[model samples]
Target chain A: MAYEQSVYLTGDHELVEEFGLLCYQAGYRVTGTAHPGPVRRKLPVFFRKSTLVPRSATVAMELTNVRTDLKRKNLKFLDGALPKGALLLSSSVTVAAHEQASWIAHPERLIGIAALPTFGGRKLIEMAPAPQTGKDALARSQAFFTRLNKEVAVIQDRVGMVLPRMVCMVINEACFAAGENVATPADIDTAMKLGTNYPSGPIEWANAIGFHQVTAVLEALYRDLGEERYRIAPLLRHFAGGNRWWET
Target chain B: MGTGIAYAAALASMDALLYDVTAEALERGFGKLRADIRQSVEKGKLSPERSEEILSRIRTTGALADLAPCGAVIEAIVEDLAVKQELFRTLSGICASDAILATNTSSLSVTAIASGVSSPERVVGMHFFNPAHIMKLVEIVEGHQTSPDALAAARGLAEAMGKKPVMAKDTPGFIVNRVARPFYGEALRLLGEGVTTAEEIDRIARLEGNFKMGPFELMDLIGIDINFAVTKSMYEQTFGEPRYRPHIIQQQMVHAGLLGRKTKRGFYSYPP
Candidate 1:
């Protein structure tokens, strides 16, 4: 009998683990954890280079780390391990999926998923395809996510995508205000919720997403776009560096 | 000018005293308050007996001296710095020393407003949004000389009025207006760059950002002229920071008298 098809999930990021569990629960055979190195060579022979490329096997990677130096290196390492013709869905919050895929051998199979790791179970997801990404690759990505019950928004390839880019800027501005003592963090949060009817205050939202994560995206944008608006606030850097200075 | 504050206080079951320059103005404000309460009763939002009791707690007068017996006196007058300074100066002498003197100014410096008074420490910014009885936010602004007691009292009063109070420094634009600049600025940039149309951007923003309204749609509801004015002041106050800079498109819209729903013409026109 032909082996039941399954996906090989591999990555060391929190998002990788979250996505793996999500796929498993949805009844897609998933193998691997947040760190898949231990089982790297022990994968079922079905997912290896055999005469048949398991039609249902897909590789999902987490490129959540915003540091381009580290992100590029990790993605390059993953590239050598990527099985030929396996649709690759990579996560990149501040780097364009196209840029990440450019260095890969099968660029046509790479699709980028942009959504906060904290927002699991969220109905909406943003997908960006590289220039070389094929129609079949894009369609397969959409079908994979739709089965997981996510509504995807296919947008132009861009750093930070839409929501993360906008949300990070909002949080960065709030940090500047907070650093200046213009308002207490609690009040800053309340003002946003009450004034703009935002789901939550920017400060509180930052805490939820982690200031480290927010600064990562901002710094990446500032580096990539070189815009003064994307500059990271000094206070955020200080807090992110200390990690223990502020309450989450 | 103090009508909205008094209306909110009265609705919260406090004995609110409303004052203005003339009895006609006071009567007009009181008339509006009555109509609002009657609407609430008609909509089944409030019982008639409760509405009448709320209205009974409100008193109207033209004399500033009539505020002498109040625990807190809030000013919601014209946006002139000098006029507000002059009023705070006089109220500092009449109201009891412990009475919390508050200004509902949206953009003026609270520290500057408090400077002219002897008890600057008692002066605080109790900014309430338009249709104060309905909107829930009341920014409790602490001027440079604002005493801890004054901050506590302002926060207490905000809570008493059933409003959520966020403590802010006496900085220009405070929190909401300052932090929310990009919501408009970036949207304008995208529109100006021909990065999709306003309607498409709005649709994407609602779908992706989960906002109740799109940026352009909210700007229209808020009145483009009013939104532009705030953006202009924030840019000016920030010493030409590029982040707060208002787009020329917004400026041109204001110049063309397309001031949104108020003028029936803005980024998008409304039928008369």
Candidate 2:
């Protein structure tokens, strides 16, 4: 596939760094430095503003922003930068399906993809279409991730996408098990890791991905879905609210 | 009853007195424990020396009075409530004053058992899962009048035995059994609605939901009768909460005695 340019809008240092590397390997012209001032950048191109991208660019990649205050402003910038025929892929941790759908000027051009910045080996992208999203836009979005050799799962748009939603529930259950004293944190982790063959224990995984991100997904589900099963454990809420893990 | 409990108690290094109404029951329990220990040693999970030491600490007797000196007695006998209460009353008089009476009842109410004894304050529920040496969870249930010191002692013993102790307030099914009901109930609901086949549901739960096993398969492994009984208990405890209600399909299977792998038929049929 031939493309004029690929723009990435993200504040996550890990994704920014990893995508910079991915762009280099894929031989695509990458624009946009996270910072306003340049500091020995290695990508083919860098721009501080989203509007600086040329009209010929066919793809725009967006990653999650964890900071609560900057999300709306970042989404506005993303909305303005998307070209008429361009495909918009969001890998946001905090962005919900409704919010993503609403942010696109041409909702038919938007597609949601879930990726964990920490695991850069391969990404799990879940495509969600807004009510106005055209089939052509969805196919182009799917093709883009396919070209990158990324795994994809098409799911209904709720929040946290698929893998993150499922994993968050597992982590929530683990925390509830710990809080109720069903098992020690270590033994529960050990049992799940050994007995169940999970890639990692829920607690350790939460710590690596940041507990706040897990809590955000859970709370969003609880709010959007209005189901008791989605209720966040009290201990998770406590930890996410600034109580240290050891303190609990 | 005696075999699983005796092996668990022995493996925990507790000096256990295995009592039975007859000598045959005592002998059977002891024989099973010895065989289990030998198997563990063969598997390299238990050393031969440690297995012998554990077996030597277990004393088998036919007399109820033989348990008089023990600090805690766990009755892993039949699930009949009347029989358990009668046993508790007898042990209350024979055991020492400070000895904490514990029941290994998994389904019955802990409070009901404690009611049978005169000094109910000393009674606690120490529920260990099957093959207790391996499964790590131990629900430490506190009856209405169970003393703080008694609960503490049970928790301390569980910790010493390398088991994780969780305290439950004498509720039906405790934590794991109660919280885990939806795992089975929801899967059955999906099956009944014709949303997916049993195998597909199992695969989706494992691959998509990340569960170790699907509800139907786990129920089959645990036996349909046992799973149905648990569902009934939770439903009755909660006064027929729709969430924990038993499915009709499960009742039909149990009525037919197609109780999973044990009877070679359940959600799926198996060879005897």
Candidate 3:
């Protein structure tokens, strides 16, 4: 939502790099990088909740898949003084716009968006407006993104809206099979594409969407929906913690 | 299914003996083969002489004993573990000792099916997708007791029949079925929860993800009953792993006789 300040993302330095490149391709100015994310390739010493909204951002885009992080950190920071109607477009993958609205003071300004890295470059973007989300806020947000050349579809507010939930859950199942050695990841990907006409293999999707974000979706779904179906696979959690993906 | 396999074999210049349990079943298989060959000839994909030659190379039989001379026997029968195992056991007894006993099962465990067969080492899974001669993918699965020679033989046959062969272990759902579960499972879950309409999900799936069909659309195309059965089979086989759980909506759809395009109703209705 905040086009003025640089968009915040989740991945380490690589995530920052990819997001920056993608932003540039979309004709947005790649401003300056914020803090370089934590370095990996070794055991994590501690868990971190990502820092929240920047003070000066006119549009605060919450681009995270984890609801807990979105609550305790990001939206939590926008408390009391959120610059009077500063548009907050939270990622609606794990939590619905209506639910995320409950956490903020002015629920009218917040809109839910279903976005994932794997969903990049699509002409349409799915958005869910909280019942309290102001009509002006929705129109302005649409106009802003439309100027950026992306069309938005407004769907009913629900957890994991549509695309993100479906795609990420598919990736999670692929990880279960790969972890169990049911088949090699490459073979699993190949079979799905050739056998079922999948646009892309789930393993390849995991890499594109980032394992950590995928795990975040499962975690949030499990916490909110309370079903074993949303439980994260151990292998996927390991990859997320390590910022690793299955090798092609 | 056997008719497709026989068509694929004969098309590959290999002699094929199509077997079934009854004269009526054999006639149905023969009818499909004739229609397929006729279509190919009409499309100019095959010359009349060549189509006749391919047809001549495929012989039909009602008795398992007639397959004794074949080097391989692919069973594309029912999906029940018990039924598949029983059929394989009969074929194992009737076919030659070295014959590759392959099951074209999509959901049953190749290992469990092989467990009851004679010379289990010779049993492998040659999982060809529907319309075997058309779909290019063939999963060559190795059961726990399947020998390397049998695996290689199945793989070799798949390649010779112009299908891409991928190897998998004797796991529930194997490769494609297991990996592809979420496409339908998650869609069904969303639908059951009234998160979005089936048409909306299919549109987003195609437009956003570039998938050819959305989970709901694909499920409708693949009978809701068939897709539901695969999910339930994987769930039970995996000891009720939540990820593979079948949704109540699909079960209800099956009960209502809204199978899919075949039944004129499913996730979406098909006009008769």
Candidate 4:
């Protein structure tokens, strides 16, 4: 089937690889792929018989761009490179994609989707629209994920979005409990699983999602809302900075 | 008067000296414990001989001095800080210096209570949930000066009682109370904001959020007065953080003495 929109992706994780492969299979053009450096060569254009193919898709995977300065520069380079109406989808946890949407030729065409590299088997895709994103952009975002056989849940434009937000809050509470020795990590997880039937105890969830990401969400929530309830636990903050209490 | 804590304490084979300011309170507590043991024996939950042995381990006393010889003393007294401090002050002087002085205070600051004692190092908060014998989580709180050995001993004792011990630093509401605040506060805020009714909020939390009980129902069971007191303590301890702020609706309910099932009136009406 012929595709109507071109999608550009940025991220080097498993989600990026899977999403790029899905886009290719779904008849979208793979205009360029960049990891840590600039795409220095022209992208290969696949053509069908007797006519010039309308190359509508431009998917770029920028996963290795970790430094904030380099990331900002790379995003600017991508913004200048994509054709008009090209959709920019970001799957990076460090940089909120919506923040860079305005720099594009069509600001309203950009949407941010939370990406899970490991748990990508689940069909649920959390979609958040940037402040400048229009209705068409939102629909395109939904359709893009839908094409990949993913179900989408739309949420407010906030760091961590919905599931991550709710899950992070639970983890934050659990960390506070663990920090205080309210219960051993094993028992805390056990009580939640046994007593309340949570999918995973907060500590295990933190370990799975990476403590830094959890701490970032908490710190963001605290900073944005200035609420003490969202204050990052000392243990979580310490872990984010690669420190453990037991070592000290 | 509750049978759970006393029965579990007896089952753990710790010599329990149940004390109250009045003899009637002690009698009621002991009677309830005895009835529970008898039922266990009849149901084969405990052998008749073991039931007798369990009963032998618990002694009732009105005098504070009776707690002196005990290796560890858990004060499940009234929640008032002044009263708790006074009791601890008395217990500190009466009990052996080596004995671990523990308060079963769920909401009050363990640090504040420890501060009242000459040997704050010996003071620790051993917060057991209501129906303590049934609830498995025991918060073992360490005050600023609480010795590592003291904390370890408290943890060991909690395990000895077959309770899961979680370490918590001395903070308002400690872990459970502090972390669990939003469960009630957000529900009340939803009520005040007119986002949802009390019944609907409770229903959503149970059905959607997967809480066993809604905030309002749990508040009623815990008593409006007690819940309000905990919220106020957390707010005050956090220097009046807005997130932990107490709602006026709860304060009004307490003023009305609609303290849930105990008073037969709260968020819902109950028949006595």
DockQ of each: 0.46, 0.11, 0.65, 0.13
Ranking by DockQ: 3, 1, 4, 2
Local error of candidate 4 at residue B152 (angstroms): 3.6
Task: Assess every candidate by TM-score.
Answer: 0.86, 0.68, 0.87, 0.64
Model 4 lDDT tens row, A59-148: 343432234455566566665665666566654344555665655566676666655433344546666677888887677667766777
Q: Give per-residue CA lDDT, model 4, range B1-272, as digits (tens).
A: 23456666778887777778899888888887788778878899889899999899888888889878988888887778898888888888998899999988877877788777988899998877766766777778888889998899999998998888877777777666766666677667547755446776555445434456777998998899988988898888778877678999999999999999899999999987
Name the runs in model 3 displaced over 4 angstroms: A1-60, A66-86, A103-105, A243-248
lDDT of each: 0.77, 0.69, 0.78, 0.67
In candidate 3, what are the lDDT values of residues A97-171, reduced to their tens digit?
887798877889989877666465776778889999999999978975675467777788877778888888878
List where candidate 4 sits over 4 angstroms from the true fold. A1-167, A173-200, A212-246, B1-3, B38-50, B115-119, B186-217, B247-272
For candidate 1 chain B, the 10 contiguous residues with the lowest summed lDDT are B193-202
| Strongest candidate by DockQ | 3
Q: How good is model 2 by TM-score?
A: 0.68
**Positional deviation of residue A113's Cα in model 2 after best superposition, in angstroms:** 4.6
* Candidate 4 chain A: worst-modelled 10 consecutive residues by lDDT: A44-53
Error of 4 at A55 (Å): 15
Task: Sort by TM-score, best first.
Answer: 3, 1, 2, 4
